[model samples]
Target chain A: MHTLHVELGERSYPIYIGRDLLNDPQLLGAHLTGSQVVVVTNETVSPLYLDRLLAILGERALVTEVILPDGEQFKNLETLNQIFDRMMHDRHNRSTTMIALGGGVVGDITGFAAACYQRGVNFIQVPTTLLSQVDSSVGGKTAVNHPLGKNMIGAFYQPQAVLIDINTLHTLSPREFAAGLAEVVKYGLICDLPFYRWLQEQTPRLLAREEAALAEAIERSCSSKAAVVAADEREGALRAILNLGHTFGHAIETAQGYGKWLHGEAVAVGMLMAMELSARRGWIEPAEVVAFRDLLRVINLPVAPPADMTPGQYLDLMGRDKKVIDGRLRLVLLRGMGEACIVDDATEEELVSLLETFR
Target chain B: MHTLHVELGERSYPIYIGRDLLNDPQLLGAHLTGSQVVVVTNETVSPLYLDRLLAILGERALVTEVILPDGEQFKNLETLNQIFDRMMHDRHNRSTTMIALGGGVVGDITGFAAACYQRGVNFIQVPTTLLSQVDSSVGGKTAVNHPLGKNMIGAFYQPQAVLIDINTLHTLSPREFAAGLAEVVKYGLICDLPFYRWLQEQTPRLLAREEAALAEAIERSCSSKAAVVAADEREGALRAILNLGHTFGHAIETAQGYGKWLHGEAVAVGMLMAMELSARRGWIEPAEVVAFRDLLRVINLPVAPPADMTPGQYLDLMGRDKKVIDGRLRLVLLRGMGEACIVDDATEEELVSLLETFR
Candidate 1:
């Protein structure tokens, strides 16, 4: 078992990663401070893990279960209200602790629910997918999607703890597992060169679902995220680097309609676009773009934007992204293999020309 | 103008109280950091003050006005979505500042909107009603009512500055003016005996809308609230005392329907019930209760719960208030004229008897 602590002063908490940690009652009990608990999971995850969690909680605390329908499209204010309605209906008070037991959608919405439930309450994350375990569950960025944009309505609320059980990854579909790898590669591309090289060398082991390789990957990703969050909790400066492909990724997600394309898949294509733009600006060699593209291809991730999406549509959708400040779009472009920088000097003409290259 | 600072560390802000302070551009501009602004107001207030505010803003910044329907009944998540829809439709970015230009409903929904819009944005409160000026606009508590409860969904998001224009009180109806006085008297009853005595002496001046009396009353009320908030920002311990009559007050608001009873009016009757229970517990002399009741009667505030409400209804509704912890109801009762304490030991049987007496 490996544990990483996110240092946020009073809001600080730990990330527990290992095999079958969900079955460990002692680990879960240490953080369940209240006499009542509300476990928010989705239909997909509930059928698999709800009873196991209930068994661990066991007669000690009054428990309420809310099972939402699964998918990114369900991550909206309407679904968020369902959690609120169920908790309020069952008389969950301010002292109740909420446990999010699914992937990114479940984690984001539940964490946000905890933040707004009676002003605020304690919440723990039990991520059941690779994308969530590596990125979404670590930082306190909790939000739901809006029709106009992705993650347009949300809060930066930290969780009490994050429990990651590697065994859960065994249940993930191959496509979903590869999608999560998009984010895992992101950490190395943004800040950690050695980790990137390590990922390149251990691709076979990682692909085989070897326990040691997966645990190390999860630990390294969370460590990188925790350090960045501690330094800039609200994304004032350094933290914005973490959203290297997210601005473009969000544009794809919003334009394509949420749930149609998995978040990791959009981000996978978005990262390639960022690298291509970075090459055009002479910030990085074009060879690096090909190298990253080759790695993504081998990992079974998408390397190009959808054929139907045009430059005009990309420009229009990207304009409304959260990264736009004072009418200027800020893009997180790669300066090198292990470096990312926020650039706002990219003009619309340049963006159009860049998008035209994909055609 | 009288300026009071709410000491909340980095989140601290100033509360400016005086007659017609809303017209002061320098005060408003000093806090507005961005060149884009969104002014959220209601139909009732837009025709009255929105144009005047726009004149002060001039053509320096791009402004988007969102006019919502008036009344507490509209203070729900559905109405909150209207603000989000308008902001997104207009392409308002994170750099835009939100200005709430109406009463408590506008301030609250706007504040919560600011708190959630792209994680958060800057917001200023221009409170046009006495009720908002004295209470909701000062505290960071921002929320919308749910179907089951009042203020069931919200956040503790502070504003950049609170602009209180006492002159707006001149346009308030007699009933609305009296509702505002309920909160003013609350400050005196919970922590300021001298202020209570002064209010008693200046009743006629206050009722007559004398500018001096109104300014002094607002200053005192904000000072008391700011002090309590600074001591405990999240209602941990010291701040909970500030909800002196809110537990019972929220119950009445939820049971009777939101717009049916103004918040302060419900709180006025709730305070009397609290005093009755306080006297029954031997915490204060019964004469003090009568004295306070007589004062409320003369001031034109409601002195009893709604005649149609039953004891069973009170228990059922109050049990769901935000003040409840682990299924135990916590009520803030007066220990004396100027001292308030949180008590959780009050029996349900005693509460039933207390409600019967009111009937």
Candidate 2:
């Protein structure tokens, strides 16, 4: 088992990565000191692992489960309110620990629910999906989508602990598994070149669910996210880099209607667009874009833009992105494969021209 | 102006208290930093003081205003969403500072709106009503009511600065002014005895809207709240005392439906109930309960329980309060007149007896 602590002072917590760690009471119990435990999961993930999680929790916690509708379309205020409503209905206080047991959608909504419940409460991330285990579970970025923009209404609430069991990945569908790898690949493109190279070498072993390789991938991804978040807990500066492909990705998701495209899938295609724009602006070579796209394709992730998504439609949605500063679109373009920069001064003509190339 | 700073490190800001600080841009500009400002007000307070606030903000800030429907009934997630929708529709960002310009209701909803937008931006409080100018505007207690309990869903987001202009209360109706005083009297019962006596002597002056007496009252109330909050930021311990009349008060408001009773009025009656219970428990004498009730009555606040509420109904409603710990009723009772203690083991019998007597 590998333990990586996200050093956020009082809000700091550990990310436990290994086989069969989800059922480990020592790790899960460390974060759950409350009398009542509410495990919030989606329909898909609950039937598979809810009982196992309950077994680990034992009879001590007055545990109750709230199974939400699975998918990104349900990741809005309405769903977020249901979690709040349930917690209030149960009369859960600040001490109640909410365990989020699903993918990024569940983790994000659950964490946001915990953030707003009684102003804030302790929540543990028992991330079941690859997308969550590798990415959303580590960082304290919790939010629900607003009608105007994806993740428009949210809060930066750190979790007490994140429990990731590599065995759970066996339950993931091939497409969902590939989507999670998109964010894993993102950490490399935005920050670590060697890790990207490592991911390149370990792709086959990770795809085959080799425990050691998967654990390494999860640990590396968490470390990268943890360091960025710890330095800038509120994403005031350094943490914004984590949203390298997210601005474009959110626009794509909103354009497609949230659940139509998986968050990681949208990000995969968005990352390609970002890299292409970087190459067009002479920030990186054309060959680099090809390599980035090739790596995504190798993982069976979406590399090309959605055929029906017009640049005008993408541009309109991107304008509503939270990343937009002072009414200007701020895109995090890659200075190189392992480096990214926030470009807030990019003119509409420049963005429109770059966006038009998708045609 | 007397300034009180909520020492929350980076999240900290100042609270400026005086008679005519509304037109003083020095304090407002210290926080606004940029040229663009968005003033959030209500229909009632807008026509009264929007021109003055805008004039102080000046042409430098491309001043935008969002005038919401006026009332406590509007204080909910629906109204909160409107602020986020408008902020996004208008493309406001981290740089934009939201000025909450009205009574407690507007300040609370605006403060909560600011807390949610872009995962929280900056906001200043230009409290118009006496309740907000003295109470809600100073403490970082920002929230909207849920159906089950008041402030059941909210966050403790501190503001950039709280600007209290006593002159704004000149237009406040008598009922509204009395509601504000209920909170002012709360400080006396829970923490400061001398301040409670000072309030007793100064009640007539404050009721008559005398500038000196009102300013002193506002300053004292804020100072006491700030001291307690500084000791406990999230109401984890000592901060719970701040909810002196609030536990019972929230039940009253929730039972009557939130908009029917002003928060301060409910709290006024709630404090009376708390004292009667305390007296029954041998915590305080019967005369002390009358003293507490008389002080609230002197402020033109309600001392009796609501007409239709039953003991069982109040218990059922208060059981939903955030203060209830481990499924036990935790009531903050006065040790004497000025000091308070949180008793978690309070029986249903004691609460029932008090309610029966009130009936």
Candidate 3:
């Protein structure tokens, strides 16, 4: 078992990574400070893990389960209200602890629900997907999708702890597993060169679901993210770098309609676009962009945006992105491998020309 | 102008109380650090002061107006979504400042909207009613009501600054003005006995809307609230005292349906109930409770729960209050005049007897 602490002063919490950690009642029970507990999971995940989590939390004075419909499309205010309705109906108070047990959608919505329920309460994250275990669960960025944009409404609320059981990866479909790799690759592209090289060499082992390699990747990804979040709890400046492919990815997610494409899949294509644009601006070498594209291809992730999506559509959707400031679109572009920079100077013409090349 | 600073370290903000503070562009503009501004006001206040506010913010790069319908009935997630829709429609970024220009409902919904929009942005409180000036606008308690309970969904998000213009109170209906004074009197009952006495002597001037008396009441009320909030920002311990009458008050509002009973009016009655309960428990004098009820009656505030509400209904509704901990109802009861304490040991039988007496 490996534990990494996100050093956020009073808000600091640990990320526990290992196999069968979910079976350990003590590990899960330590974070449950209140007598009552609300386990928020989606339908798909509930069938697999809800009973196990409940059995572990069996001795609690009260335990309520809210099983939401699974998918990103359900990650909106309407669905968020469902959790609120159930919790309020059951009379969950300020002292109740909420445990989010599912993928990113479940984690994001539940974390947000915890953030707003009675003006914030304690919540824990038991991320069951690789994408969530590596990205959403560690960063404290909890949100729901809006028709206007992805993650348009949310809060930067941290969790009491994040429990990552590598065994859950065995249940992931091949496509979902590949999608999670996109974020694992992102950690390399954004800030860690040695890890990028290590990921390149260990790609086969990672894809094969090797426990040692998976644990290493999860630990490194969480460490990099935790450091960035500790430095900039709110995305004021340094933290914006974490949204390297998110602005473009949110555009793809919003334009394609949420749940149509997996978030990691859209982010994969978005990261390639960011790299391509960086190459055009001479910030990164074109060959390196090509190499990254090949890696994504080998990993079975999308290397380009949706075929029917136009440069104009991208511009329109991206304009409403949270990254846009004062009518200017802020794109997180790669300055070089293992480096990312927020650039608001990218003109519409440059973006259009870059999108045209995809045709 | 008298300014009271709510010392919250980095989140500290000043409450500017005086006549015509809204007319001062520099005061309003000083806190707006963004190029774009969104002024959220209700229809009742829009026609009265929105144009004046827009004139003051005319020089901004972009100014958008979102005018919602009036009343607390509109203070819900559906109405909150309207602000998000307008902000997103206008492409307001994280840097855009949201100015809430109305009474408590508008300030709360707008503040919660600001807290959630793109995971929060800067917002200013331009409270147009006496209720907001002394209470809602000063503290960072921002929320919208849920059907099951009032303020069930919300955040503890502070504003950039609070601008209280006493002149707006002159336009308030007599009942509304009285509702606002209920909170002013609350400050006396929970914390300051001297302020309570002063309110008793100056009730006539306060009722007449004399500027000096109103200003003094507003200043003293805000000072009391600010001191409480500074000690406990998230209502962890010290701040629960500030909700002395709120748990019962919320029950009254929820029972009567929002907007039917003004928050302050319900709180006025709730305060008396708490006082009566305290007296019954030998915590306060029965004579003092009558004295408090007399003061409320003279001020035109409701001094009793809705005649239709039963003791059982109060128990059921109060069970869902945010103050409930581990299935225990934590009521903020008075130990004596000018002193408040949270008590969870009050028996259901004792409560029923207390409610039966109201009959």
Candidate 4:
């Protein structure tokens, strides 16, 4: 098992990467300070992995379970209320620890649930999906999607520990796995150029679920994320660069409805749009755009955005994204495949042209 | 204006207590780091104070207003959802500062909104009601109520500053003013015996809204709370004592349906219950219980709980309160008029006897 500490001082916690670590009592045991444990999972992953986790948890604490309905659509105040209701019903106090046991949706909801559950509770992410393990599971960013924008209601609450079991990836569909890779590729595009090149070289191995390569990818991606989060923990300035493709991605998701396109898939196309815009502005050469698009395509992600959405609609939707600062659209544009910067003055005309070209 | 600093290291903020400080730019000015500001208020307070606050905020940055329906029934995931929706629609980023410009309900919902808006945002509490000025405005306990329990969903996010405008209380109803005093009297019961005695002697002065006495009460309550919060900023252990009457109070509010009884009114009755139970357990003398109940009655607050509810129902409700520790009924029992201790193993039979006696 490999371990990386997200250096957030007292809020700092470990991200453990290995195969079958979910059943490892040592990893889960380190974060359990109390006797009451509530495991939050969605319907899909519960049937597959709940027993393994329950077995690991043993008879130490009273383990309560809240199984939510599956899908991004369920990620709202209503679903969040359900978790709160369960917490109230069970009389779970601040000392009660919450364990998130599913993909990004479950992790996000559970983290936020823990964040607001009695002012906050100790929550550990037992991520069961590639997307959660690679990206959502590490950062303190926990949120629920809104009808207007994706992830509009949330908090940046760090988890007690993240227990990532790579073996759980076997349960994910190939398409879902590819969707997660889009975020894995995101780390390379934003900060680590060498990692991007390495991802290009190791795509086949990662897709084939090769243990060593997949482990390396997850480790490097987390390290890059931890470094960025540590530097700008709240995503105030430098962290906005991490939203390289998220602005366009949020719009795409909102326009298409939340559950239709996976967040990673939308981000894949969004990254393509960002690169196309960067090329138009001469921030990156046309070839880097091709490289970015090719990598996303290789992972079976949607490289080009959907054609039906108009530039105006896209721009309007993007305007509603959380990244927009002071009502101005702040686009994360690339200097190269390895670097990105926030562009605050990008005009609607520029975005419209970029959207037109992509369509 | 009286000033009290909440001394929370980096999260520390000033509580400005006086009349007409809401329009005083210096209080809001020092905290305004960014250009974007979103003022959150409820329907009742908005028509009264939102415009004045908006005028003070001026055209600086992109100023937006979100008006939620007034009352505690609206203080839930649904209302919190509306605030997030408005924030997203306005493109309010993490840098945006939210001003909670109402009473305790508004301050809590707004503080909670700030806590969840992009993981967290800078929030200022411009408390209009006396209850908020004395209690909710200073502490960082921000939350939305749950269906099963009051404030079941929330966070302990500190604000940048708290501006208390005593002038706004001129418009407050007598019932509302009395509810605010219930919290004011709480400080005296927990750790400030002198303040409690002073309140005992000066009930009319406070109820009459004498500026000097009201200001002193607000300042003293804030100072005592500030000291307690500074000692335990996160409510780790010692802070639980601050919730002397809250276990029973939460039950009253939940059972009566939130907003049916003001938080302070429920707290007033709750404090009486605490005293009754404490006296029955030999934690405090019976004479102390009489004094506590008489004081609540002096303020025209409920001494006895509503007659409709059963002791079992109260037990069930209080059992679900967030203050419970390790499946035990953790009550902050008064040792005397001025001091209290957390008694974690209060027996249900003892509680039933006390409930019957009180009933």
Worst 10-residue lDDT window for candidate 4 chain A reads A54-63
Winner on DockQ (1 vs 3) = 3
For candidate 1, give the lDDT of residue A316.
84
Worst 10 contiguous positions by lDDT, candidate 1 chain B: B54-63
Residue A199 shift from truth in candidate 4, angstroms:
1.9
RMSD of candidate 4 to true structure, Å = 1.9
Candidate 4 ranges with C-alpha deviation above 4 Å: B23-26, B33-35, B281-283
The 0-to-1 C-alpha lDDT of every candidate, in the order given, reads 0.90, 0.85, 0.91, 0.86
lDDT of 4 by residue, A59-138 (tens): 66577899999888899888988888777777787789999999999999999999989888999999888888888998
Clashing pairs in 4: A155-B119, A156-B119
lDDT (10s digit) by residue, model 3, range A252-320: 888888999999999998898899999999998999988998899889998878899899998998888
Expressed as tens digits, the lDDT of each residue in B191-269 for candidate 1 is: 9989988998897899999999999999999999999999989988878887878888888888899999999899988
Query: What DockQ does candidate 4 have relative to the true complex?
Result: 0.72
Clashing residue pairs, candidate 1?
none
Docking class of 4: medium
Put down candidate 3 lDDT per residue, B188-294, tens digits, no spaces.
Answer: 98999899888889999999999999999999999999999999899888899988788889999999999999999999988998999999889888999888889
Query: In DockQ, how does model 2 score against the reference complex?
Result: 0.68
Provide the interface RMSD of candidate 4 in angstroms, 1 decimal place. 1.6
Cα lDDT of candidate 2 equals 0.85
Off by over 4 Å in 1: none
lDDT of 4 by residue, B157-228 (tens): 999988888888888999999999998989998999999989999999988999889889988999999999
User: Candidate 2: where are CA atoms >4 Å away?
Assistant: B60-63
